[model samples]
Target chain A: MTDLRKSDRLIKLGLLMIAFSAISALFVITLFIFEQGGPIMFKYGLKSFIFGQDWYPSEKIFGLWPMIVGSLMVTLGALIIGVPLGLATAIFLAEFSSRRLARILKPVIELLAGIPSVVYGFLGLMFLIPFIRENLGGPGLSVLAASIILGIMILPTVISISLDSIRAVPDCYREGSIALGATRWQTVRMVVLPAARSGILAAIILGMGRAIGETMAVIMVAGNAAEIPSSILQPVRTLTSNIALEMGYAAGEHRQALFATGVILFVIIMVLNTIANLTASRQGKR
Target chain B: MKETAIEVRNLNHFYNRHQSLKNINLEVYRHEILAIIGPAKSGKSTFLTCLNRMSDLIPGARVEGQILIDGQDIYRPEVDVVALRRKFGMVFATPIPLPMSIYENVVYGVRLAGKNNRPELDRLVEDSLEKAGLWNEVKDRLRISALKLSGGQQQRLCLARILALKPEYILLDEPTSGLDPISTMKIEDSLRRLKQNYTIILVTNNTKQAARVADRTAFFLMGELVEVAETEIIFTRPTDKRTEAYLEGKFG
Candidate 1:
């Protein structure tokens, strides 16, 4: 009995050590980014660093307004393309479709997430870019292409999480609504959707995070023009692309500016995650 | 001398291959509280769901008998199922508050029926809550979450939600099973008053609850209804041995 208890204690300590290591890694990365990036923001003034549109690192002019706009534009475009399609698919899979049909379609939809980001970029490069250039009158690689690619990339996250939350609604609510003469659509609209609203909102925030943070696909499809695009058809550079594209050649304060870009990205994601947690916990308490 | 409000003839219900109700024949008079008492899984709840056609929501659930409400067969195809469901209000064994404010919970059904006028809704909310014996307790904070209320209050909120629909029949399936005695008594008082305006079909696990509020009582055993008669007769001189055994604590 003593031996068993000692082994159990050792196992618990090992698991705690492993968990602490993972958390400490996060803390270390956060500290390192802030350490490398903080001095630039302090020296340059937060307003100029954040709202400056010109981003020539060699001349020591580092305004990130274009990248910030680019990130917001692409993420918003992705949401426009994704949310309706994802929510409709989730509702169909969770509430409307036959069990056998949902069974057949669910894995295929999930398989979308398993596809490497490069493949999606490749597909966008091959088909979507050419189609956009031919029809919408821009260079093949533009914000539209990246937006479409990122939109498709985030569908699995949105659909699966929304589906889970919608399914989590108690059947009793549906029964009560139906008993009150609510049509299936009414029941879904009034009760199930409201009950699942926080979760769906959290899913949307998560998908937004995924879209904003995606680098490879955006780098591949986005033309990487550092200037703010006047139109949706024009090329733009997102923060992730700016970091990944210039980190190789950047030196001195230029490199520190890239780290600062990462710090901004980190803060944006942290804010989004915090909001998602708040929405989810509020619903849980309800 | 009494009008038949609902008639069941040779009713048989099945979930997949499992038979739940076997040849149930009964007549419910208008403006009467009819209590159905049975042990667990004795088809009591199944009978109540069938009345409101809530059984239709369950996959693989089949009904092979005719239920005529107001002399119209309800099982026929091309029936307006949504309209049919609105004819009866149902309260389940557990209280479900729809995760909204108490005012919204009461007004949910009326809003679904497209009655959204504000003053009209307010009146409906107050009237239904009054009828359910919950207005005085909940009137001060109609905007509070129904979940914040006690279990008993939530059950009464469920009743108020039903009453807001203005349904012709109230079908309760062990609604007070989880409530304390005082809450149960409040509901019983509401039922006694409600019977004047609505036909109430109560399926209960508590025989004493039926004895307290039911005008007529039906005893069911297995899937079969053993006896149905006036409440005093069923309680004082039960004709069926199973009902006597059940009531005497011989067995469930």
Candidate 2:
């Protein structure tokens, strides 16, 4: 009995230590980032850093308006293109497609997600950029190219999350709707989609975050211009790619400004994550 | 001499290669409660689902049967399955109200069928809730989510959803199995009143419930219909020894 009690105490202590260590690691990372970036942000004033669009290292002037706008435009474009296709694919997989077709398609979608973002960027650069340049009459790298590539990259996430949500609905719900004289598509649109609304929203928000934070792919195709473009065909610079491209060479005040951009990007991602978490909980409650 | 509401002829069903229901024949009279009683997996639920074509919803399920609703063959290729289902609604064992407000849950079927006028929807919601015996309790809280209701109220709300469709026939698969005694009694009372206008086919393992509410009772064993007779006869002096043994608690 004494031996068992000793072992139990030891296990409890081990678990406590593990939990404390995990939490402390997270706290340490957060503190380190805040300690490095907070003073610079306060000195510059958060509003000017956010609203000022001019980002010139030589003149020591940095603003994020263009970067923020570029991120929004690209993410919105991706959502516009990806959401309907993802929803359609999810509905087909969940409701209409035969088992064999679903079996074949689901793995293909997973594979699409598994392909490295760099590979996608390379593919976009080689084929899609040239196609746009030849056909649409613009430079190879543009916001349109970045948006198209990001949309494809995020398609798998949207389809997978929406499919899981739709599948999570009870079989009885479908039967109930069908028993009410709803055709297959009608049941999907009226019953299944509404029931999976929060989950679908969560999926879209996650995709939006991915589109906004994506760096390497956007860097390869977005042309890295620090100006808000008038059309999709023009070049732009997202906050993530701007930070990645200049962070290594930047020093002193310039580096602090780059870290400030990192801080802003971090805030945006945090907000997106909070929204995703809220919707996820709402789905659970439903 | 009563007008038949449903006619089942040479019905057989199989789950994959396993036969779950054998050749069966029966007729359900209009405005009467017909109860199906059986041991677990004796194909009672299967038979009830076949009446409304719900048995075929699952993949790898096959049915060899002819079910006629009002002299029209439901199994015929030209018949619209959706329309057939709309005319014959179902209630499952567990309460499954849609994830919406109480009023929306009640009128979901109507809206699905394209009735969107607010006053018409309100009337149907009130009438269905009243018929299901839930209006008095939920009328004030109609805007609240349906899932917030008690288990019994959720079951009744499901009933109201079906009732809103104004189906000629209602198939209930153990509608009261999950309810407390009082809620069970409420459901039974609602069914009693509902049978004045709609035919009801109920499947249950609760023989006492069958005796209490069913006008007629059918006993099933090993996917076969053992006997069907008036509820009193089936309980008090059944012709089939299997039913007698079951009712006597000898062995299932």
- Number of the top-ranking candidate, with DockQ as the measure: 1
- Angstrom error of the Cα, residue B36, model 1: value is 0.9
lDDT leader = 1
All predictions: root-mean-square deviation over Cα?
A: 1.9, 2.3
Cα miss at B19, model 2 (Å)?
A: 1.1
Worst 10 residues of 2 chain B by lDDT: B48-57
RMSD of 1: 1.9
Q: Estimate each model's TM-score.
A: 0.95, 0.93
lDDT per residue as tens, model 1, A191-214: 999999988997899899999999
Question: lDDT score, residue A67, model 1?
Answer: 95
Q: Please write out the lDDT profile of model 1 over residues B74-188, one tens digit for every residue.
A: 9999789999988899998899989889999999888888888999999999999999999999899999889899999999999999899999999999999999999999999
TM-score of chain B of 2: 0.98
Off by over 4 Å in 1: A1-9, A43-45, A279-286
Model 2 steric clash pairs:
none
